[model samples]
Target: MDPLSDILSVLKLRSYVSGGFDASGEWAVHFGSHEGIKFHAVVTGECWVAVDCEAPVKVKAGECFLLARGKPVRLASNMAAEPISLQFLLPPTHDGRIVTYNKGGEFLSIGGYFTLADGQADMLLNVLPPFIHIRNEPSRATIRWCVERMRQELCDPQPGDFVVAQQLATMVLVEALRLHLSARDRDEVGWLFALGDERMRAALSAMHASPGSPWTLQLMAKKAGMSRTTFATRFKEKVGLSPMEYMTRWRMILAADRLTNSTETLSEIGHSLGYNSEKSFGTAFKRVMNYPPRQYAKL
Candidate 1:
């Protein structure tokens, strides 16, 4: 599989279409800091999104913004509009249903939050910008489809609304990240850009496709078609980790998923990732996860 698909497949991304809002006249809403990644898509009208100390971003109809790190942001009809805390506005048992806020206004939007099941999401996804904005244009057909499907599903709930909406939200996130990555400079020194490089892409695909492989520095360099020193330097420069470091981390991440989702013995899991013994695998897992495999599996 491709690098982006490989990373996302193991991340176990799940999205929830939480209630949305429709506001008109003069109004503002503060969705304070949250843990899950949050997003808002402008379905109609326009509004300004203001994060602390930054200028407000004007979001017109058909535009969308994703708060990848769940940063605190305020949406307002105007810069000076007094805002109400979103925490106070929603009902106590706010089910995952669309709700209009300050009804009778022009700005209309659907919003939601998503979570990554993988505990190592920060390490794997930190290369992304804090916020990703995608304009509604022909070039962004995938994003447009996600936004439209999510809006349609949420507005008119069906028998399997939860599953359908969640899937749509997942697609939205993937498309958003793809667009974000494609917009960056080709020479950017990050894993996101590294995924686009032919040389680095070959190495990454090799590492991901076979985490259990007894990959040596020479073998990895050969895969990238570069000398050992050149490969090491470029790998570190682009991916921010030595090749083996990434491999070990990836193995641990895969091990964590297996431990959580499967009924495998510790030794079996260890050997699957090229560990000789349960003790060695446990040590590595603890170092990366700050917990033993047995303990983490229960969580």
Candidate 2:
């Protein structure tokens, strides 16, 4: 698999918001929008997640739930069952889009947008489950700390408090994801686990270390200490792409970053990445990115 693609799958490129609501006698909050990922953290209250397609999932304090794919869900408190307060940490938009929150009573939350500027974050996203419910496990100290920091930042009326709070909140989410990947079942292979494997890690490192090298299946297989057929099959199973396909994707990813961050001529970038000529590089770049190199660079 292309490490860049894997990483992007994990890094959510959307806006986020964090806040809380006091449930007075079974009040319910309905979130109905095709926005970004929505995360509900039960900081001090209890609630139930009622969705149309699935049974209602109960929530309690110190537990966090993610509503992936921005599916519409309802959160409610049933006084007849349990008494709980509701806190939410959610994206502000879907797909870098914008979201508006009509401020309710003393809701304490933080939110921000996430984008994968590099391969690391992208690899993490691909392995994450569609919805992750994190119990207050022992290994989640970092996540807890981040969440507490978010609460502190949200409460503090300091200048740039929102900015600081949002950053912390984002960090918390990232850490949570990291914890999830580390503890995820080994049988459920995801891109993150693939990158972490010894063999795949070495191959990926080699590719990144020398993107312009004449990488071949034989060479990669040798580096991985596996037979050519074994290497190819394993790589495909783990990465969801052939070796050359992964290489091409990585090259395009590097090219896009260069286009955005550097002033190098397109031809120079092409040559740097082992392209024979500017036109050849341009064609490859366009095919992968759906934009001319120069045009993409301007963005």
Best by TM-score: 1
Query: 95-172 in candidate 1: lDDT tens per residue?
Result: 866666766458778898877775767854477666777877777887777777887887787899889888888888
- Candidate 2 local lDDT, 1-299, one digit each (tens): 35434444333343344454433443555666443456656666566776546778777666677655456667666524532222242353432212223433322222333444443343444455546677777776776676666666555556776666566656666666666666677666655566656898788778877888888899998878899999999988877778888888778877887777678888889988989899999999889888888888766
For each candidate, what is the lDDT?
Answer: 0.82, 0.63
**How much is 30 displaced in model 2, in angstroms?**
1.7
Candidate 1 TM-score over all chains jointly = 0.90
Identify the candidate with maximal lDDT. Answer: 1
Off by over 4 Å in 2: 1-17, 34-36, 50-52, 79-129, 185-190, 291-299
Error of 1 at 269 (Å): 1.0
